[model samples]
Target chain A: MTLTTTLIAGLVLGGTYALVAMGLTLQYGIARIMNLAYGDMIITAAFAAFVVQALPSMNPLTGLAIVVPGGFIFGYLVYVFLLSPLVKRAPDKATLEVDSILTTFGLLFVIQGVLLVLFGSNYTSYTFLNVPVSIFGTTVAANRLIALVLALTIGLMFYALLTRTRWGTALRAVAVSPQSAKLVGINTDRAAAVAFAMGTALAAAGGTVISMYQTFTATGGVVFTMKALIVVIMGGVGNLLGALTAGLVLGIVETTVSTYLDPGLTLAATYTIFLAVLLWRPEGLFGRRV
Target chain B: MLTLDALSVRYGKHIALDNVHLRVDPGETVVILGANGAGKSSLLKAISGLVTPEPGVSITLDGHELAGVAPHRIPDEGIALVPEGRGIFTALTVDENLALGAYSRRARAGEARQRDFIFDLFPRLAERRKQIAGTMSGGEQQMVAIGRALMSNPRLLMLDEPSLGLAPVVVGELFDALGRIGASGVALLLVEQNVTISLELAARGYLLEVGRVVGEGSAAELKEDPAVRQAFLGLNA
Candidate 1:
């Protein structure tokens, strides 16, 4: 019974991690943006969900319809206004990486500051579908179950889109080889912008789901960012399926450690696994050596 | 027709191409023959919009000027370049690579037919449609590159050293495939160091030396020229 509970809880947490990590992977992989501000985007959407839930008839799912598109537009505008110039000026990928990291680091503070001013530094969450539901003789919160289902559905849909559609294939081509993508007549800049926007949309969706079951402070964006980054690197950067698997593994391990050992050691356990992966497989678990 | 007039490209202090003038008529096969560092790759790169030519240079496909067109847009203008080193997406499957070949709007309408044509042209690609391209041998990768370029339904197909580093037997088969592609009425602009096979494949040839076109003639005329025989064919006449 305890094992089943741990597995379910870990899966719920892992589903959210997978959801968020996919967005980061898309941004870093296709757009080539490190996106240090990614978690801030999530928190922003969470706050948006919170505000919507406080209204008379609005719900987080309804908030998703607004927040996801808003996230996409915000990301597109950011790319056009904030990042395109850097892309044009940079001579090579290495230079672009350095430039983007610095630019987004500044962007991180700007977004976090805005979030702080708007929502304050208080831990915020909303109660939604808090009823307990039984699954295989274990009871879990209905909201968390919904989040898991939504995350898996969205992630799988995204995976299908990437593998099935021509446009998605072109995006993957850009990620795989941008120069070669141009040879096939793909506008790499436009693709990057769209990819960045899609990533942001996913981040928004993840945030909306997370808001239902977890309390998130405006200043706590860094932790989400770190966790997502860890999952992305563990799965292999730019690899969608890898991100999903790595996220679940990380979630289960974290949960198992917190349950069996001490909850205080979860972060230490996370870092231990991360350091081991880095030392053993720096390219990532699924990444191939170039 | 594709026309280039006074095309010049420089890399810092070194001029890679100098006032090069050339043309490829519809459905015609033209080959550029030169030794190493003779600016062969630059000419193809210039046409494909991968490299910017000097100001006042003119590059037109049919009646449209292509001097400042973006590289990705060039495929939409009916030009496809199989660059040196076979720039196929190594991470993608053969089918996915070919599907992406028809990504340009112009090629999208005829994607199905173009894919069929590619499969017919390189039957090996049909068998390896699901296989990751990076695992293929060098010659097979070149086939994927050519098939990918053809999938764009290009009017003018440009190749830069397609036979480089391939085994002699593979080179022979590759040219045989190129010969069939030429027969299908796509104008071919080839840059090759292998003089004998290229001269046989092309109706006309241009000799580029030090980034300039030093000689131009029919294949038969150049094949018999003593200077060509000595310089390229390695025959002391």
Candidate 2:
């Protein structure tokens, strides 16, 4: 029964990780920028939720509704102000990637600084739909179940948009080659902006889900970002389905080890698996080896 | 009609295209022939907005200035370029590649008709619609590249070195497709190192040497020009 409960909890956690990783994947795929500040976007949304829940009968979910759109606008602004100039000035792809990493690395510190000024280093946690339900003789939190459903729904919607819609097709084209996308009449700048917005919005959603159960500080964003990076590396950068699978596997392994062995060694065990995967399949499980 | 007056491109101190002037009337096939580093590709790049031209250069297509227009807006202005190296998205399937070609709002509305027209032109594309573009042979990839450009319903199509690195039979097949494209009333601006086949396809030809148009004439005149024959066609004195 304990094993089953741990597995269920792991799955719930994995679903939210998938959401965060999906945003990272989309941003990297379209813009070819490994946005190191991705986790800050999520924490920003979480903090936004914290501020909004001060009102009577307000909840983190309500803050999510507000923050999601704000996340989109913020992401767009970031592209326009920060990323576009880098792209314009970049002499080559390798330079763009390097510059973007350095830029986002700086952005990470900026966001963390702002959050620290506003919220301090104290850990904050919020709750919503805290009801517990029984599943196959194992108890599960209703909020986590809801989170799983919501994350999976969002993932499916994203998949359909990428594979079905014209905008999605243009985004994929831009991802492959912005130059070719331009020849086909695609505004690559617009595509990149939209991709950033969508990615940040996903990060916001994942942050909201995390806010429901996890305690976070202003400096906590990097931890989440690092976890998502592990997932991305294991899944293959830009492979959405791969992210989902890798997230779940990571969650399961981490939870299983923590439950059966020492909780303190969870990260160590996780890193071991990550290193093993890196040694065996560096291109990721789903990625085509370039 | 497309007209380029005083078009120039410079990479710092090096002039890639120096004050070059050229024209392509409606439905006309024009080819620029030159050896490596002769600015033939740069001329097409300048017109396509891929490479920004220097000040005082004017490029007008049907009386609208193409100079300084955004690269993406060029297709909406009825111009499409099949860039060097086929430029097809190798990861995408053939059908997806063609679909993306019709991405502009103007082309999107007529996607069905354009797709059908392309399929009719290359039935092989229809047969291999679901295949990943990268897995295909070079000849097939080139066909996809051209078909993708056609899907935009471009008034003027530009190609850079379409014959580069293809088998003789494949080159023959590609040239046949080029003839069909010409017949469809789309104006063509081609840059080629393949002098013989290009001259046969184009109504007029320009010889570019170190970013300058050193020679210009009708196809027959260029074919008979002793200098062109000696330099490009390898004809002995």
Candidate 3:
């Protein structure tokens, strides 16, 4: 009974982790950039939420409402301002990816440092609304449940965006062949900027939702980032369905370990599972690992 | 009509094209022939705005002078290149690949017409519309490339080695399709290494040697040139 409960709880939490990984997968998949700052950018989003909480006019969730779209715009600017300049000099995929990783790492360090300086080091927790609901004989946290719903919804929306819409088609075309897309009059630079922004915005949204459920610090992004990379690799780069299944798998595993052993061992178990999955079947659950 | 007046391109100190000049009047077919390092691909790239030429070396499309226009605007200028190596969006499905070709606002306006035209032109594309382009045969992908270019409704179409590495039968079919396209009034600029076939298919042709126009004439005139026959057509010099 305890195991089942743990599994259920873990699955819900895993849904949130999937949300975190979506952005990572998107940027990596389309642009072929690692997006190292994606995790830290979430930390930036969390801080943005904290600022909203401190304000008299808003709560944390409302702050997220304001910040989510803004985060996308901000992310777009980051790609345009920071990443675009480097892309010009890079002619191949490997070099562009390396440059993106280095640049994102620099960006992540700067963002985390700024937050630490402004907010101090103590962990902060806040909830816009906390309402519990019973589901299939189990009590589910409203925020986790909400995160699960929003994560899946956004993930699906993201998939639809890439596949169905004209803008999505243009983006996918750019991802596949920038030269051909341009020859047909698709603005590849604009497409790259948009994809980068959208991916980063999801990172912000993930941070906003996850922060509401638990305490967070200036340093939580790296952890979240690692978890996201695991999910992305497991799911497959640029593969939406792959991320979802991988997210659920990671969730179930973490919850099961926490239930059976010590909470301290959860990280180890997660890593163990990640390595095992990686070694046994590198393509992840549904995605091709490479 | 499109004209390149002394267009020159360089990679560092190395010259890719050296003050090369050519002209393609509206509703005409012209072929550029060359060896491996003969700057044939660079010429197409320059005209498409993928590479910039030195100052005073100009590309004029209907006399607008496309000196620094970006790649996205090239199609809007009534010019589209079916680039060498069949640059199809392999990860996308066939329909998605064709749909993306309608990126220009003008192209988008008559998308249905373009789609219908493509379906008629390449029936195989319509049959495998949902399949990923990467999974298709080489000849089929080339058809998709040409069909995608046509969706933009370009007045001037440039094909860079459309027959590269394909079987002779596939090349024959492609040229036959090209003849149909030429008859439809779209000016064609063909870059090819297959000297005899290109000249045979084209109304007029330019033979390029290290980025310079070494020979230019009507197909029949060039075919009769003793020097041309030896150098390009594998006849005795």
Indicate which candidate wins on TM-score.
1
Candidate 1 positional error at B89, Å: 0.6
Which lDDT tens digits does candidate 1 get at residues A209-247? 899999999888888899999999998888899998888
What is the two-chain DockQ of model 3? 0.60
List runs of model 2 lying over 4 Å from the truth: A53-58
Give TM-scores for every candidate, taking all chains together and pairing residue i with residue i. Answer: 0.98, 0.95, 0.93
lDDT of 2 by residue, A176-195 (tens): 88889989988888899899
Rank candidates, lDDT, best first. 1, 2, 3
Best-to-worst DockQ order:
1, 2, 3
- lDDT for model 1: 0.91
Evaluation by TM-score, superior candidate among 2 and 3: 2
Q: Which stretches of candidate 1 lie over 4 Å from their true place?
A: A288-290
The alpha-carbon RMSD over the true interface for every model, in angstroms, is 2.3, 2.2, 2.7
Give the least accurate 10-residue stretch of model 2 chain B, judged by summed lDDT.
B102-111
Task: Kindly indicate the candidate among 1 and 3 with the higher DockQ.
Answer: 1
Best by DockQ: 1
